[model samples]
Target: MKKILSITLMMLAFAAGTSAQQLEKLFEKYMEDERFNYVYQKKPGMVERLNDAGSPDLWVFEKSNASLGRRMLTLNGGEKSLEESFTREVETALKADKYEQVSIVRNGKNRVETYEKITDQGIAKVNFIKNPGNIMVTLNLYAQKK
Candidate 1:
């Protein structure tokens, strides 16, 4: 019985890790879907620098350190079935990843939520925005500023 419990625990831990990585897989899976729009940045520094130089007040990433990279996936004007399915998948991944919900803002038909997960290197932030006909998920990775 003890051995069985130990194996079960290990399996659960492995599943959690895999689910966390599913978020990235989710992005890759839908990136080329005609129903979605995708944007990826290898180095988000240029945009961060521009934001810092232009509007210091709006540059909040500094609080996390420096921007290492960013990826955004947008689902726009899709069928109700597809939208529902995508939403479910995103929610499942977030829950499995154990990301802490940092903030949520609701304005009329639009809702924006932020989640953060701490890593050894730094922090990973996700911004999820949903409107009546649109859903956007943005993942931002930050590294410790040297």
Candidate 2:
């Protein structure tokens, strides 16, 4: 019984590690591509300040501490095939991370999908926005307020 428990724990740890890596690998693969624009903010506290200032997006960041910073990757003016490929990769990464789709909103040609995953360190949220010819993926991590 002890051995079984140890193995199970190990498997969970490995899953968590791999899930975190999948999204990072996807970001690395496209960050330098000329067709994509990558933005990474090292200031997780910035979100906290925004929350303090009473931003409308507070509903999502409520009772949270963004300790893991934020990253955004945008693909603009790409071919249909490229856009589709990126979308597929993002979907795969989110799935691998065990992220749950919390909400989806669509207005005309613009659509936004939000996914969230709770981790040991915090909650990770992803905002994926799709427009007529552009796709943007943003990752945010937040620790629950104690």
Candidate 3:
């Protein structure tokens, strides 16, 4: 049992490294979009590992090692109508044709949405959070997707 657990951890670490690389491209792509200005990103390892043995705050994307990146973005809500429009635009993009809706959880008025898409590059996992203060997105890569 110990051997099995260790091997699994090794595999996760390897995939996490690959995920770190692929998600960087996705991050750069989002940077091109004009809607977001206040952006904060922490590469895979920069943030602490997602709790595995312990309970997860949100459900996993599909399998273990599927989520590996974190990004926080803010919209310019200078005008109420503009903020609503931006929010709608982002939500629509998240549900684009290629992406599969993984899961969604609600905490009071806040909404968290997770989506994944498998491409030649890898599996892209994007998470969107709609809260009063700002919108946060945490993008992950599942490089070894079956």
Candidate 4:
């Protein structure tokens, strides 16, 4: 009886640990995908175009090594407010049909926000805004590999 009880407890502990790890992994994947999509859609090519036009603008997001980490990219430009431009660009990309159940939020201290398409893999959260001399963008993506 004692051996059986000990074995049962050990199995339960292992199961609990596995579940916790899985949850953490899921959160990390979600954040990574969210950030990657935001950068891929917004920065890279667009910044060069803005620069060539003699615009004081460039943007990039630096991601963390870990999943579910805080990632931020900033855009630099001389405009009084890049808010409208940022919104339009994001809206256009989202409308292009890459993601579903998309949502956008404005008027928050953080500025523009949107949800990436939910996939069988996971979820993604993206935020963008014009702050001081730069436009700041952030992404939180969650994906789980089957």
Which candidate do you rate higher for TM-score, 2 or 4? 2
Decide which is better by lDDT, 1 or 4: 1
Q: For candidate 4, lDDT tens digit of each residue in 6-119?
A: 999999888765653332243244345432222333232434334433523311121211123334445555355454554455555444424443445555454455445554
TM-score ranking of the models: 1, 2, 3, 4
Segments in model 2 whose C-alpha atoms lie over 4 Å from true places:
1-16, 44-63
Tens digits of lDDT, candidate 1, 22-85: 7889899999998999999988666555764465653555653777888999999988888888
lDDT of 2: 0.83
Which scores better on TM-score, 2 or 3? 2
User: How badly does each model clash, as a count of residue pairs?
Assistant: 0, 0, 0, 12
Candidate 1 lDDT score at position 84 = 84
TM for every model, in the order presented, reads 0.83, 0.78, 0.54, 0.36
Rank by lDDT (best first): 1, 2, 3, 4
lDDT of 3 by residue, 34-103 (tens): 7666454344442344442244543343344444445655554435676676567566555542567888
Evaluated against the true structure, the overall lDDT of model 1 is 0.84
Candidate lDDT scores, in order, read 0.84, 0.83, 0.60, 0.46
- Between prediction 2 and prediction 4, which has the larger lDDT? 2
For model 1, which pairs clash? Answer: none
lDDT for 17 in candidate 4 is 59
lDDT (tens digit, per residue) of candidate 2 on 77-126: 89999988888999999888788999999999899999988877888888
